[model samples]
Target chain A: MTAATQPQRTGRVRRVGERQEALAGYAFIAVPMALFLVLNIGTTLYAFFISVWDWNVRTGPRSFLGLGNFERLLNDDIFLIAVKNSLYYTVIWVPLTMAIGLFLAVIVNQKIRGRTFFRAAFYFPAIASSAAITILWIFLVQPGGLFDEIRGALGLNPLFAAMGYGPTHNWMGDPATAMNSIIILNAWTTSGTFMLFYLAALQSISNDVYEAAAIDGAGAWQTFWRVTFPLLRPGHFFVATVGVIGALQLFDQVRIGGGPNGDPNNALMSVVLYLYNAAFIQVNLDYAAAVGVVLFLVIFAAPLVQRRIFGSGPAW
Target chain B: MSTDPPAAAQRPPRAAVDQLAGRIPSLAETEDVGPVGDRSRAWRKRIAYALMIGYALLMFVPFAWTVITSFKTRADALRLEVIPDPFTLQGWEYTFARLDPSIVTLFINSALIATAVTVTNLVLGSLGGYAFARLRFPGREVLFVVVLATLMIPDQLRLVPVYVLFNNFGLTRDVGQYIGVILVLAISATSIFLLRQYFLSIPKDLEEAARIDGAGFFTTFYRVMLPLATPALAAVTILQFQGTWNGFFWPVILLRDRDHYTIPIGLLFFRESGGFSTNWPPLMAVVVIATIPILILYIFFQRYFVEGVAASGVKG
Candidate 1:
């Protein structure tokens, strides 16, 4: 038996069960990859195809319209508003969320008393479904709502009260404030997730570094900037990348917060909401796909630029 | 106005430190940095904590308001009182009874769909993870890279085509809705890839020895790999469970009939109830109920959560 299995150096006279072993490996990936291809990959392709055609469920598919859908999208005013609002949200929310997240991570990562409680409390919002919280946030941001009540108590809502849309806190109804309301809500719900990422990165930093810094006479500020920030460069990059992706894909909160029409004058109409409107609300699947394709390019291009600039990992 | 200017205008350096410096031990809050320096650091820390705490309070305020309003009459609710006075359960009862039958069924639909999705994801994801980790076949790295590439697709970009395909598949309604949701969720590449990395990090000597003992690939997988990979599995379990539980867009798209709607989708029908009514109370109640399982798991398995998330990047 030994001589029968002796090396011919071809590596082909392997175990009797080589096929089964390979089959096992293949089996593992097959189911998930198939589902992924069906739901994720297929949808991506289909969306791209739909974008170029005049496909509507009622009227059926037709010849491709090249970039006509995108032309329409560019001129749609509402689409322009959506694109602008998303950018505004991204620019405002990313830095605010990062600052808060880092602050919380630094606090809780110090392993203070009631640290677990603080962590749980901070993470509670993240655990609740986005839809549920968006609904609750709409309630809070409404006139005479929780924020307005607190604002009135603090006497900071002078102008809003003077205007009088109820308590003149009709945050979503007023086109001027709808986008800001959504951004604030985004920061609140998602900061916890960012906090967790920072916490994870913070914990991975060696404690010996802190001890060494203490001996060198470096103060807290010095420790954070010199030792901590440099060490956390990788984590910072990751959060930035993930944050951009998430912000670009914003949908649930805006849709639920602003309602089906995306608030007055489409002030809060994000790209995803616009796409949903085209496909489901207006039944223009092709044009919706066109919007999706634009978003995909925008999202995918940012990461490519990020990769070029960051050049992979911390320079250190 | 009398701020110190470096060494020129410095007071005797707040000799509080010198008084006890030699005799006393390390004080974390030493005014040792400089006068304004110490206060600024303290101020920054305080501001950080205040921002975090204020944000957290703002997030919870809506839920708190809902709870308070849930126990009040519509007249009291309209008045927007600080405290819920003359409390009653009528709002809660109205939410449960006055709501359509579809709203009540939403809880069960959401629960069943989430549970199914979670179960399928676990089984499929863990198996793929195990194979990817242990079984190094031809082109394994290429396959994994392809799988990881899928993560780059923004979820919003995939909505249109997926909805269309599901409509074509006869899985868009009734009992099939849960199946459709489960299928969509089952393709998660993260958990599968994560578990695989965790599995690979384990020493393969035991598995090798099992193979030498003539145990088949399936046997080795079940006996050695699965047991040691329990923590990874648990982490993925909670992660996928929470993700599926909170799935809003899918449940909305796939379940057209209100009766088949999940909790988030079901709660949405309450918006049609009136401008504001007792219906909001029950929706809030349902939100609380829906969040309980996820909160419990997250609190209990926070460590694993940290591990899973960290390992994800390490593998990437």
Candidate 2:
């Protein structure tokens, strides 16, 4: 019988289904939800409310600051720097990485030999220890290091000289180069992961579509532009938005490579990096709480608004 | 569209594979084209392969540098030499000597935590998935809404309170800190969402047969449903494992001492740059070694992981 008869056929077990589902659902999810309430939900609410006060539980006298904590976020020099760096990082890191990721995923998703190997090799960097990878990036990018040696050997040094490398800047050590370095490493490590997602989506798209496009006299470019690209739009938006969210909370590599100071001018000091400093290094829990609250608002609000605008809107 | 007049324009349309694989010669086997395809696909093919190979090399070059760096002496590392001036096994020797015992503990600890999270998520997330898929109960939709809501919260927003709660439970800054972290990682809404989709797509015949055999709800769930969900379970397992193993932020926030530090934290401690840049030689070695597990994982379970990652994106 089809779905129309599904309800009628199962009359004997009908009563049991509802009660058992209730019991089983509660039984199964009870543990995880409790963990969520403790670790996530309740904690989230507490974090928001706590942001407003001088919440020094250890130091006593939790003075009411009202929106004073949020006001401080506007004026705090390092906080401003952190915001600037985070936005810069988001701007650079998300698009470049997602583009590379989508490109690589599209390439590898084709019926290539050693598909697993290429996928895994690209993906391995993502799973490699972040701290170790950070240190490795430093060695590769530092002056007279791997990147320098390779570039020099490939006549890249001469090209860069012609295009002004030495006269322009030191890469990681200089303020300008620091965030760029982080962005480069971040893209290298992450492209494979998002590529995997793209691969899955690409694979899911039927061969019929391509064949149909060919039948319609669509060239490769036309098929890709008119069909594949538009169809992949949903996946693209998801990848882009997730990339944005992740970039805003850029903590790991920055912390590992540059530390809280970012570059000399604090050019790469990410928001979460500053949160880390406020919480762990500087022991200013109140300010950190405030930062966390503001961050929550920004991240939460941005995505919903973006989803409404981009994902929801008809393509131009 | 026919803007071409050069000798290059005389070439034939290419196999789609040729576009992604530059090495492939003009393999136009069929006469399939319109004016849009009048220009040789071979040119586009050439461009695509060049881009793909270029990207692959860019991805690999740094990693190759990291490997060579891992073999360098501390002095060699400092000098920025391309090849080690006189390479020593000292870095590897030192990494192993310091690493073997403590890192083994961290590895095992990490494995146990990831495994715990994976197993718990597989059981709970899928059960919840199946419940949502097959059985309707009061407020089941609302419960799901609550679960999905948790996905939107930034992880850091929950950290302070979870830290406080874990502290109260005596799981802080000490040995065996995995308890707090693993449970937190396990309760992901996206996993549940993924598993439930797979489960709902299941045909009802198997369960109906089991019910006919006089099976109770738990019996049918355990015997019939659970075993049938191997693919989805495998996918969720690998995903959760990756999340758990590569977890840095939570681990960094909770665990203070070196002994308790996971591989990520251990790498950080070992690569202490000390008022300058990092000791990337040993760090790269550690990066390679640390990634071996994830590599091993992908080798065995890539089919599952890739599919799961793909499935989790839009569905997640």
Candidate 3:
């Protein structure tokens, strides 16, 4: 009779302990989850709700628009321009940044001298604030500045003139060059980060794969393309997805470089910058909320689109 | 000895094994290769080094130019000179003494807000991370997925609503602005996910052992888990601090008063109010000052920064 009671008592004690553990788990996540719900999820739902209303700070929810704001966005030239510029920037910047990053990673991954210094130097620009970098970039690209000096020294000004793009163009002031200038800056600043990603991926590849390639008498180019690149599929997917998401939200440099109105013909205007201008500068909260929703959809759709193209499974 | 010679001859050469391991076999190891191959390899190495050096220099020129420009007089700053001619500290003096809102004020505000945000993230992230990593509460997987799904939703989507929400709460004004910004960034999905990933990597035996010794959930986490999570905590600290310090978008929206402006917004204000086209030197000086703290952090904690970035890229 005592032995029979012992199992039952132990089972009850185990259940009690589990109850306490569950309580502790809930307690641990309580503050953070509450903050996340109110700030992240709550704000997101509020954005959707306000998108249908004409919200004004003074009067609050002045009128119900019922998708009118989103419809208006379709006809808005500045909004279209902003969208086009963001897509253009992403298409060019993402590939350029990833390529440069991969190249640097490959070089640094080699058992060569001063690779650590090279890695650190490449990553330096990434650590600085975008505002600071943009300020520096403005000076670098100013008329008769370092870029112009280099253009003149390289005899590239005449080449540009011959191509009808004009010689000695103002990099940040000219509509034709302003967006490109921002793209160049973005790539320069971000490529080192992608380089670190690629380096980690490279380090993880097993030596046996290289051994197999060597046994097959594969040349360096063939080995890289056939073996290394395929092995880095996961890294490629991560970089591309993150890159697209980040690129779509381009604002700080553009805002600083071109001002809130996206000066010099709105060439540097991005979707996020437009959202900012709408909400704060123009004081149209409802319209801005609609813009915010569209931006979210676009950013959300990017990875799905990438996954479909890349054939997704586990990323790592 | 005769049997050993045959067995050894049947095995692959040491040089071949090294080559297979992805190392470039040394000259003596590859004696069968001709001079043509050697020359080509040498040329390839030279080209690789040249490309790396060239890119590194290109990446660094803007920074070097910014430093030079800051030391130059306004007139001298306009030129494309490599070095400052007749260098002076007028720009630095003007920035420190004459700039409204003052460099000191901006620095302090940024430091205060970033520190508060970093500490909050570390505490909350670890709690949530620990619960998700070790606890067996109902709905854990779904809740964790919810946390991750929030990451895909761009911040711009929530910007307008978050702004309006805080504005309604009167949190976008003066001291309340600090509360608003801190609340928005206090805990991030990335931080929780990172810490969770880190915790998951640790052996479960440690926590299990603590539990067996009659330690409760909180005690096990605090005593057995937290101390072992130092590396992850450091990574989270660096990433969060850098992110908050350089944050611009939310602060620009939330902080209406000049007194509460962070470094990025302050830099923007300085640029616009200083009449950037004419006052290049002092603006550059301000940029330099704004960047130094992050640069110093990156220098000292370079490994943590790189590891944090790589871990995020791989596991995020």
**Top of the candidates by DockQ:** 3
Better of 1 and 2 by DockQ: 2
Index of the highest-lDDT prediction: 3
Q: Please give the DockQ score of every candidate, comma-separated.
A: 0.29, 0.31, 0.43
Candidate 1 C-alpha lDDT tens digits along B156-249: 7787787777777777767777777778777578887777767766777899999999898888988877887766677777777777778887
Residues A36-129, model 1: lDDT tens digits? 7777778788888888888866445778798899899878988888898888888888888888888777776653346566776776677788
**Tens-digit lDDT track of model 3 for B187-283:** 9988998889778777789899999998989999999998888877898999999999998888888899999999899988877774654588888
Judging by DockQ, tell me the better candidate of 1 and 3: 3
Candidate 2 segments whose C-alpha is farther than 4 A from its true place: A1-17, A57-61, A109-124, A162-164, A167-170, A200-219, A308-316, B1-51, B78-87, B99-101, B273-279
Return model 3's CA RMSD, one decimal. Answer: 6.1
| TM-score, chain A, candidate 2 | 0.87
Per-residue error for A19 in candidate 1, Å, reads 3.1
Q: Which candidate ranks first by TM-score, i.e. highest?
A: 3
Query: Per-residue lDDT tens digits of candidate 2, residues A105-219?
Result: 7667655555556777677677665776787777667777667766776766777888668622467778867888889888888888799777655655656776677668775
lDDT of 3: 0.85
